[model samples]
Target: MGYPQVSAREQIIPSRVPTDAKANALEIGPERTVIEITHVGVTAEGRAVKVTIAVAPVHYLTAGYELRSPDTRRSQTDDHASR
Candidate 1:
């Protein structure tokens, strides 16, 4: 048997920055907040299987000050992964 053909599509939903004073002070900025992925497999029957994935950002920690220190810079994986 051989592997079936597959097609995939991914979309990054746009984000809107909050206008409220408290929200803005919290450093909540415009970021790609949502991602949607769709996969489709094809076979002799025409359409074989379909799958979809929706991803969102999860804030493990919310601090009043920045987490990264000036002495040591850290990768912004948390922000980028959501996109």
Candidate 2:
């Protein structure tokens, strides 16, 4: 099998996502977007690989107002797992 040809614009993955994840969410066009996986495979030693056969645009919104309520106290949720 041959590797699929990906365009320069389609190759850019956002920085907020972890490198090990098979797929990631990206914010485009002023909304939250999800990119679904078309195919995924694993090697003999248990290493995983992913392939994106197609992409479609979907619109989503976040409950930012509820998560960022002024009355609620903000706390650090990051556990310093990577850093």
Candidate 3:
């Protein structure tokens, strides 16, 4: 059996929320927080194939946030067919 190839990796970070309009300050201080994210890809045989790590501010951990690798096989096939 073969493991699926990783096509691309994407990371999304949240924007800082403004605490004061005139002072132009963020609600969450970057120095006060750390967000560590890990992405592990496993093969069908239950073996670890790849691992990814990312670090960001705590405020970036908002809802709907995700880190992942999207399959590029489908897009590759589509490109060949279009040609």
Candidate 4:
């Protein structure tokens, strides 16, 4: 959690990940290369919040894999989850 703080707009809902990484794709799934942490609480200003953070090794994502957009990767995850 050494990362920077999220703005107010990002404090409530979880994002529609697999997040896009531009030219660098983020690969996640059976390899378990991605790690996510979620926290649900109230902000100091008293707004309810839920947050999720995703962590991955840059070396593996940018390494040898054929890069694909998160839109493409999201479906793969959804397909697997449906099974």
Q: What are the TM-scores, per candidate, against the unseen true structure?
A: 0.27, 0.21, 0.39, 0.22
The Cα RMSD in angstroms, rounded to one decimal, for candidate 1 relative to the true structure is 16.8
Tens-place lDDT digits, model 3, residues 19-73: 2431233344534445555667765655667878665556446557455434676
Backbone clash count, each prediction separately: 0, 0, 0, 0
Candidate lDDT values, in order: 0.43, 0.36, 0.53, 0.46
Q: How does model 2 score by TM-score?
A: 0.21
Q: If both were scored by TM-score, which would come out higher, candidate 1 or candidate 4?
A: 1
Cα lDDT, model 1, residue 22: 31
List runs of model 1 lying over 4 Å from the truth.
1-32, 58-83
Say which candidate scores most in TM-score. Answer: 3
Question: Which model, 3 or 4, shows the larger TM-score?
Answer: 3
Cα displacement (angstroms), candidate 4, residue 11, comes to: 15
User: Which lDDT tens digits does candidate 1 get at residues 1-83?
Assistant: 56565533334343333335434545544442332234455655565455564333324222253354544433466556768
Clash-forming residue pairs, model 4: none
Cα lDDT, model 3, residue 65: 48
Model 4 residue 83 CA deviation (Å) reads 66
Off by over 4 Å in 2: 1-28, 53-55, 59-83
Task: Give candidate 4 regions above 4 Å deviation.
Answer: 1-24, 27-32, 43-47, 57-83
- Write one digit per residue (lDDT tens) for candidate 2, span 40-79: 4445544444445444343332223223543343333333
